[model samples]
Target: MLWDHRRRPHAFAGIRLQEFDAKAGRLVGPQKTIYHGTDLALVEGPHLYKRGEWYYLLTAEGGTGYDHAVTLARSRDIWGPFETHPQKHILTSKDHPLAALQRAGHGDIVDTPDGKTYLVHLTGRPTTQHRRCVLGRETAIQEAYWGDDDWLYVKNGPVPSLRVEVPGTRDDTQYWAEQRYTFDAALHHDFQWLRTPDTDRIFNVAGGKLVLTGRESIGSWFEQALVARRQAHFSLDAETVIDFSPSDERQFAGLTAYYCRYNFFYLTVSGTETGKRELLLMRSEASHPHGNLEMPFDEPVQLPDQGKVKLALTIRGKELQFYYAMEGQELTQIGKVYDASIISDECGGHANHGSFTGAFIGMAASDCNGAEAKARFDCFVYRPVQHYTDRYEV
Candidate 1:
């Protein structure tokens, strides 16, 4: 439910069901209000379930924080007089600090052909003591059963388990490998392009290369060119080979671990007014409002003559390192390790603006002179720590 303006007693003027209308190419036709929470302020993420002659309405409530929970309501008709469950909350992670997953809510019920039901929902894992969620929100599944009173109950009663049993008929042998995007096809759905409103087109892919047209610098609140993907793990290896000739001293293109519009780290290929091209590694923080601090490098190094350079960033624990490599050569460390927490939700301040969006690592290109320079990426490779355990068994 959303509102454009205030309407006296009620927060919103109209209450409508959320649905997609493919014919109109947009979310339209709420049809009618089937259900709402007793505390409407905290109600969202609703899912409909049908059993026997009853239509069950499941909703996530109490905000998307430690107080989050899954509650239910039911009615005989599809659209009226829905009654909240006596239990109020069917699942939650409140008070379960020791549990592997916390802040659990937004559940969806999936029924198998064998009559078994399961609840799949969003959950988070905070660090051991800091209570900072480095892995961000993740999906978890829990088995469900119907009681004699016709109420649905999770197998372990509420807090999700670290070890979940899988169905006997489910496959247990498949495994996943590292992700490598050659840009041989479409950009992976996980990748995102960052830009400001009314920005010009600056991204394209053709001839097996992902090209980005340079615009304003990364710090620009107006039009800028950047493409990135989420940083899903504390330990990960991300690399990309970029090809961009610096026609002017103000042009730069490289890799970055972006947290928000104000916080990030960059390892870019740039040139000086004197025409000396080099790779620069730097970290930007909101606390240091003046400008970014340049990372120390081991020795003097310059960009390759061909303008094709491989840029890599690795995150292990709280340390982040940058590297560079030429064709057919080993990757050489470009600078000393730097703190990786700046690009995190817990850093700078509370959730506001872009901080709540999570961290991302990808390519960035900028031409401060508005020269419309372009940068081409050969490929992007990402290798995250893979967990092999029954807890992630889906």
Candidate 2:
């Protein structure tokens, strides 16, 4: 069942179960609507669990503010006419000693095979001067149980630390294998392109490339052509071969880390005066012009006869390295390392707080007049690194 909080009048605040046919492997029935309205403001992190005769729908709410909390609602049927806790804010900051000074919310509930329930949530770090809050939100785990009234409760307040046993690790070699995604028409619906996307730009699906006709160069204020997916601390590699002979010499196309219009890092191929290819990294701000970090390759790696060349970016922690591959081999290491810290609040940069959201990887092409450029993305793969395993129990 998928919940849509963007319902009209904000009345449909609960769950909506879409019936599906196992044989056909597709949705089958008219969707059944459950929870609704102010009761589920910005409600997310929904996990359904069945025990005995009861089916529970656990969710997080409170608008990503200091008052954010985790709550519960249950029903006997899967498509629930569910009932919430008599008292809201079941698993909240009030229960933690450190919560009063900071804030914690957006929690996910995980139950063990042994029947132990745990809550994992994001919290702001505490410091002497509260003015400086790093965007790096930390995740902590705690033990939880139901009260007499059927309300969920966590041990300790604000910052609970339940000494629960960590689960055994799985054989990750089989799990870490690369999975391939073939570009299909059905992907338009299955994949979430963005949380909040600019409606003005049109994504040319037929052209096999996302074309951005918008004037904003990803660093603009009103509308920037940016699309990303959830971040999970994984290593990703993608190549886009582009043909840019349509315009005179003022066209560009490549990969970027887009936070917003005023903040992002991009590596692109621009037309030089002599009609040669030049690789450059552009960073911009609302108050200043684009900052270009010229990354000159040994020679101008020309796009194939198709007028398209492949570009790739590899992310490893605070370092995002760029590369260009022609044929099947990497041509030159585009000597540009974008310090992820610059766009991260943790390293003292002016950017939004990175809460539950992860970084997104995608391609972009823009600023061409008659010279129609087409970008063909050969492949995109995300593989988890060993470092993440060292940091978290996952």
Question: TM-score for every candidate vs. truth?
Answer: 0.79, 0.56
lDDT of 1 by residue, 321-352 (tens): 88898877899877778877667655534532
Which RMSD values do the candidates have, in order? 4.8, 9.1
Q: Which parts of model 2 have CA positions greater than 4 angstroms off?
A: 1-103, 106-142, 147-152, 155-175, 184-201, 207-216, 222-227, 234-238, 246-249, 285-307, 343-356, 368-373, 388-390
Off by over 4 Å in 1: 2-41, 76-80, 168-176, 184-190, 195-200, 206-208, 247-249, 285-307, 345-357, 386-394
**Highest lDDT model number:** 1
Over the stretch 143-200, how does candidate 2's per-residue lDDT look in tens digits?
7766675556776533455334467764667555554433544334323443235433
lDDT of 2 at 184: 42
> What is candidate 1's CA lDDT for residue 174?
29
